[model samples]
Target chain A: MIELYLFLFIMLIAAVIATEIKDLLAAVISLGAVGFSVAIMFILVQAPDLAIVQIVVEILTIVIFVAVVFRTTHIDETIGKRFASTHILSMVLFSLFAFLFLAAVVQSLRELPRFGYATMRVASEYIRLGLSECGGANIVADVILDFRALDTLGEATVLFTSVIGVLALMRKIGRKR
Target chain B: MRGMSLVVKVVTNIVVGFIFIYGVYIILHGHLTPGGGFAGGVIIAGALVLRILAFGVEPVSEKRAEERASAFESLGALLFIGIAFAGLIIGGAFFLNFLPQGTPLRLLSGGIIPLCNIAIGIKVGAGLFTIFLALAAIKYVMED
Candidate 1:
């Protein structure tokens, strides 16, 4: 519990640093830190599947972001050095919105079941019959591949479509020479 | 982007094979392990990305390599759909377990799951590598 809070605190600080920093590369690194903190929190909640995916995705995204930054500029040119009245007003409004968002999150968190107490409604069946029915040792794998396989198929289709879209958009030559 | 320093190239050469094998292990052992196709595929793509970043591009063949990756990606998607179609024909349901489900905790336990994982692994690895290759216009190598 305390460790969770510590991670949340680290995440919050890193997110703020990511937003506030002027160096684009440093900000991207800070964002990576925030992602790692979230991955840690996912592990603490006993969701190794989510943690593995999150950690790998985080690393790949950070790599992409760094690549982009290296190709572009290092400094953030949009933010001005001098503060203005509109800046102060926007900052105040942003703080208020953040406070409201935090309140809503806290309320939702309070409504959730206590830690280590998973209320398995449909998962109860998966636990009881997953191995015998699907013949897979990993229940998560069985659920994704056997029980809800259509969903996986749909996801694969979506990925395929996106790849096609990328390929179509980035073609170098349209006609043969 | 030319090849990195000698030290980086040597290290990458030593480590990339392990990463690729580990990714395949994760995909093959999806039913008995924590990782599956998507995770394994991403890891493999990461290995490819690492290799490209370390060794840089061979000036003339990157387009051909990218085309090969695109072909693999399409082939994977086609294979996945083909498997699902096979299930529909045999079991009267899409994505059904048409093959015999071996004993639990075994490598070949899940009937169609491992097959699906392989298809997805190929699709995701090839798709991501294709995207990286397409997006990064690293045409000019750094003249030393």
Candidate 2:
């Protein structure tokens, strides 16, 4: 819809403004807002899981930024130079490529088979049988924990590694002192 | 540094408390709701950050929070692995749900899911909190 496009346009403008801002703290806050806006769009498109992940990651990133900013100068003097003519040229090229890719995707969608109905039917059937056969109360949870346990395990391992990495970084800082 | 306004302190504390409570609720009801462990954990960490912002870093006590979070992180990882091992001992596949299936779409249902959510919540909350504390520690160190 026109409204959706308009909203996206506004968000893009906000993102650029945020990045161009002179104040580092304000820029970080604006970037967080941009992330939230993208999360909202994701939810509007019926991707609640993705939206939640985006919001969480963005919040963490903002926290990290705040921590960094506390140690650094607030004024960002490089913004103007960073967005020079060469940078603008590269950005234009990047945008062109992205636009082309999106156009191709939209065009392909018209020719794609209408599998939404079939997918829903299969999912509903799975929900019914999965409960009885698998003896799991929540079908989605069953699929995630039982059927795709390996994926869950891998994700958990990644989280564990990141935790260790953080600890190690902190210890290194302590050692330096 | 100048003292903070009373209103700001009160509002920040209230918001932080709300975030913490909501995080716990989300983690507990993960199976029946949209929120899960990661989301809940991040919300809890956000609350910690809010506290840090309202109160100064010195008042927030990074050392104490780090100790607790590190312990929680280790415990969570151990518990998660232990649960998976329990499934193996029960002659089911790894991470299998050996418990009886209660009524669908109800609380206390999804045996392993609830347990997993709890483990994940602890792991993520502690992990994220540790990261924040570490970053704050870096700032403090650099200042000195």
Candidate 3:
């Protein structure tokens, strides 16, 4: 529990650093730190699958971000330059929004069941019969690949579509002679 | 992008193969382990990205690699859909577990699940690598 809190703290600090930093590359690295902290939090919460995916995806994202940064300007020119009235107004509005978001989060947190006591209807059945039906030791795999295969298929289609979109955009407009 | 230092290249040459194999292992044993298609596929893509970043290649060869990645991506998607169509045509249901479900906890078990994992693994790995290559190959107009 304490370890989880520590990770959460690390994530929050890294997130703030990621947003507040001036150097684009440093900011990207900070964001990677934030992501790694979140991955650690996932592991602490006993979700190794989520942790593995989060770690790998985070690494790829950081790599992509760094590549983009390498091809562009390194320093952000706009940040910390001036504090205009509009900036102050936006900050005020952001704080208000943050307060409201916190209130909503608190309400939702209150509604959630106590830790380690989550109740389930469909999940229980999946746990009991997933092996016999799907013949897999990993129930999560069985659920996703067998019972919810349509969802997986839809996700694959979505990925494929995005890849096509990227290819189209890059080949047509992203290159100039 | 230019190649990194020789140390980086050497390390990548040593590590990339292991990473690719590990991704395949994850995908193959998904039904018996925690990671499945999506995570394993992402890992494989990461390995490719690492290799490309460490050892930059000629633009011409990179273009060829990008085209190959695109083809592989399409092939994976086609294979997944073909599997579903096969299940429909033979079993009269979409994504039916038509294959024999062997004993649980074994590699050969989980009739259609492992197959789906492999298909998804291929699709995701190839797709992500294609995206990265496309992004990297983009010509920056401002460079002029």
- lDDT (10s digit) by residue, model 3, range B1-144: 589999999999999999999999999999999898999999999999999999987677877898999999898898888888889999999988889899988999999889888998999999999999888877532343
Interface RMSD of each: 2.0, 2.2, 1.2
lDDT of 2 at B99: 70
RMSD of each predicted structure: 3.1, 3.7, 2.0
- Per-candidate clashes, comma-separated: 0, 0, 0
**Winner by DockQ:** 3
Please list the residue runs of candidate 3 whose C-alpha ends up more than 4 Å from where it truly belongs after superposition.
Answer: A173-177, B140-144
Higher-TM-score candidate of 1 and 3: 3
- Candidate 2 lDDT, A98-128, residue by residue in tens: 9999999999988766743544465667766
**Each model's lDDT:** 0.86, 0.75, 0.89
Provide the TM-score of chain B versus the true chain B for each model in turn.
Answer: 0.93, 0.89, 0.95
After aligning candidate 2 to the native by TM-score, how far in Å is the CA of B112 from where it should be?
Answer: 1.0
CAPRI verdict on model 1? medium
How do the residues A1-177 of candidate 1 rate in per-residue lDDT, one tens digit apiece?
Answer: 899999999988999888878899999999999999888998898777778778888898898889889888999976666488888899899999999999999999998987666686777888888888888888888899889988988999898888888878766656232
Q: After superposition, how far is residue A19 of candidate 2 from its true place, in Å?
A: 3.1
Alpha carbon lDDT at A43, candidate 3: 83
Chain A TM-score of prediction number 2: 0.67
Q: Ten-residue segment with the worst summed lDDT in candidate 3 chain B?
A: B135-144
TM-score of each: 0.91, 0.80, 0.94
DockQ of each: 0.65, 0.52, 0.80
Cα displacement (Å) at residue A153, model 2: 1.9
